[model samples]
Target: MGPRPEYPRPALRRAEWQSLNGEWEFGAGDEPVFDRRIVVPFCPESELSGIGRRAGDVVWYRRWFDAPEAERLHLHFGAVDYRATVWVNDVEVARHEGGHSPFTADVTAAARTAENVLVVRAEDPLSDKTIPRGKQHWTETPEGIFYTATTGVWQSVWLEPLPALHVTRLSLVPDLRAGAVDFEVDPGTDFVVTLDGEVVGRSSGQPRGRLRLERVEPWHPDSPRLYGLEARLGQDRVETYFGLRTVEARDGRFWLNGEPFIQRLVL
Candidate 1:
């Protein structure tokens, strides 16, 4: 068997979603009141989050969503740093906390047709001195390369269908040599590709097909070009973006943007 590919970020997708990724309550020692706006997928410490102040180890995030007929529901978190506890409609529904990656919780039992309240509490020991602390700075006095810390919901929270018969994943591999992208849908299905609301490419009956597109814009620092795709399954549709580029070794050196250089890790 071949190596399984990495699942796309924001994987638990659905055509219908109430994005609770922006801002919400956040505080430690006491539950937060009122809401603050923060960008999903970016930590509070990041410029994207807007709420630049470092949150303490524990903070709560609360929001509401409405489901029409009360089908099984899935709660998705793009990436919540460290550990987190989740509640739905005032009822404890799920819990997860890790600074990297993503996770999902089945919340079918905790949802109502009207409005569902969600609460999340996150905690991290900053610098445990023992665990792999990544870029998290648990210090009140942030020093050195360490930046601020992000607690609570630092990612998008969305609802996905709890399908009775099917669940699938898709991966698009750009093959410049073939002048196309190898699109393979797990539990494979038909799909289409588009760009700027225009149908640029597509895959037919076969689950795995080549989606060819012209104007091969080599993704680079100077000229970055990307294509969009929308895959269909039953009544569900998903949007994805792909780039055409490659990395190769030349003259015992690494080249990026057709230039010989060493990548710098500022973090």
Candidate 2:
């Protein structure tokens, strides 16, 4: 869960994301504390924390960021524990339950220019039945392959800023034969695809502020091409990269890069 390189997960926009992954101050107030300082994203019970023990305690994390005045400041988490209550600048902003998926909260209203305190209170009732506890062993079995009970802040915590009116997402499909990629964008004003900050393709806009991507490249596998999208919507600009490739079936088999293929399943 450490700043997972893959973004636009579940398809929101990537260029609008800000990573809040790093050190965080933890408070094991009135809890059965274990050891000392712990790194973020990784659970307190894992070896990565540098303090590996069953410290299923509620932790507090604080950080600050400069948000665009026109941007909609958003807070996101890859995943939390059994239950988590998030507070932005000492104001409760989000409360989430369920340990399987992900969640987010917009803290624009409760934000200020000064320091912002992000406190997360987590609790896990050891015998949690409703949650999907995959690979996490809740019992007291210390070693052997199973693990100790890990509590709060078990995943990545981040902040993302969004443009007032922006392209939230884009979809691309590769046409191997054409050696280009097709596109579908939701740009509010205009969007230009770039690579390494160099403009490669662009889409125009209507006079009233609507943009549509009509002409585009057809992506092919051998080239393994991609288009870097830089869309300007008012004052906010979004950035993301899309691959031009397709997955298909041929003669009861899958094909990648327009070639006959055989998939592997080695376990």
On lDDT, the leading prediction is 1
Worst 10 residues of 2 by lDDT: 206-215
Backbone clashes, each candidate: 7, 7
Cα miss at 48, model 1 (Å)?
A: 9.2
Computed on alpha carbons, the lDDT of every model, listed in order, comes to 0.64, 0.64
RMSD, every candidate, angstroms: 7.1, 5.3
Q: Any idea what lDDT model 1 has?
A: 0.64
What is candidate 1's TM-score against the reference? 0.70
Which residues of candidate 1, in runs, are more than 4 Å off?
1-15, 30-55, 68-72, 90-92, 160-167, 194-202, 205-223, 252-267
Least accurate stretch of 10 residues (summed lDDT) in model 1? 1-10
